[model samples]
Target: MAKILMITGDFVEDYENMVPFQALLAMGHEVDAVCPGKRKNETIATCIHDFEGQQTYTEKRGHNFTLNANFDDVAASDYDALYLPGGRAPEYLRLDSKVLAIVKAFMASNKPVAAICHGAQLLTAANVIEGKKVSAYPACAPEVRLAGAEYVELQMDEAITDGKLVTAPAWPAHPAMLKHLVALL
Candidate 1:
């Protein structure tokens, strides 16, 4: 089974975090979710982001997500792949030196890295998406391009895999994202 590391924080998209976590487990893979300054058993507040015909998505409070690992103790080399779930959390997580370093380490090793929605912010911050074809939340297109990456706009339910990196526009693309990640693993 592949060992995966997932990084998340407060206000992480509820579905983006839970669905993949459970799906990976059901597939016999081990996933350890961690957040900066958070320890095992600690919980991060989550929020649901759904489209309701509005110009943008609506947000609602979601169940608290529990961390199963400690971020300070994580060594990128110990995991087979990395997962980044998008939400408001990525806005701040991208500013963390530790988080950026972990992301860089994974990409540097050419390990499978999966990201969705705003999660692409971290990839841009880590400076690892340059020259790669990526698909992310529409709002992220500019930054993705500025990062030297070719942003491909796809349907919400689709995903784009470029080398070891897998990205999608949102949670609706979970199935495709997971499939690509599993293949890479």
Candidate 2:
């Protein structure tokens, strides 16, 4: 079993993070979820619109995550791999220099790195997406391309592997993405 570190910030995609996290746990892998806040309970932000275009709010149990570990406090040598769940969280995380350093450290070490949706934004921010093939949410196509990566416009079922980097389009791609990831582990 691999010891995986999952990094997140505020406004993470609920199902996107939970499904894979649970899958990793079910596979007997040790999974640790890290977030920016030390809230014993975290709220995942999701977009749910009803038939009448009314916004509905729903909440689910999230990993009682650690906010105490600053990006600088974490060393890449301690973990086998890293996972970044997508959503607006990546956008915020990208701004943190510490987080960028962590991303660079993982990429430099050639550890297996998995990202979905906007999570790839951090890769772009780390300047590690160049000459790589990747996939992400449609809104991120131009950014990926600008980072000198080939972006594939497929569902997560079409897993992408470029060296140590593995990327999926969105939540729908979790199963296929995780399957390929587990193989690498």
Candidate 3:
């Protein structure tokens, strides 16, 4: 069983963060959900993103997710895999130096990394996916390209795997993303 490290923060998509965490645990992997500046037992609010008959996805208030690990205690090399769930959090989490360093460590080590939706922002910020095939939320295409990665446009329910990276467009691609991710594991 692999020990996984998940970096998450407030406003992370409900499904993207919760699903993989539970699924990995169910599969007998150890997962430690951590957030910058937060300690174990602390909670972060989540948001649900839905695509109703609208031009873009809509966000709604979601439940609070509890953290099981402390960010300050994270040692990237201690984990075998990394997970970066999508949502508005990536927009800001990318600005954290520790977050970028953690991401870089994983990529440099070629450890399995699973990121969905806007989570790709962290990869870009870390400059780890340059020249690699990556799929992310449609709105993130430009950023992915700007980071020197080959943005792979995929269906909302699809995922793409390049090396140890498993990326998808959004929560709709959970099944595919997890499948690809599990294969990497």
Give me the runs in candidate 1 sitting further than 4 Å from their true place. none
The backbone clash count of each candidate, in order, is: 0, 1, 0
- Identify the leading candidate in terms of lDDT: 1
Q: What is the TM-score of each candidate against the true structure?
A: 0.99, 0.82, 0.98
As for candidate 1, its clashing pairs are: none
In order, what lDDT does every prediction score? 0.97, 0.76, 0.95
- Candidate 2 steric clashes: 1
lDDT per residue (tens digit) for residues 1-185 in model 2: 89887787666676667788889989998776766544434443443111233353343434433333344346677888999888778988888887788788888888899998889999899898889899987778999999999998885457787777889987778878897788778
Candidate 3 lDDT (Cα, 0 to 1): 0.95
Model 3 per-residue lDDT tens digits across residues 1-185:
89999999999999998998999999999999999989999999999999998888999988899999999999999999999999999999999999999999999999999999999999999999888999999999999999999999999999999999999999999999989988988
Output the better candidate (2/3) by lDDT.
3
Residue 113's lDDT within candidate 3 is 96
Question: In candidate 3, which residue ranges exceed 4 Å CA deviation?
Answer: none
lDDT, candidate 3, at 99: 99
lDDT of 1 by residue, 1-185 (tens): 99999999999999999999999999999999999999999999999999999999999999999999999999999999999999899999999999999999999999999999999999999999999999999999999999999999999999999999999999999999999999999
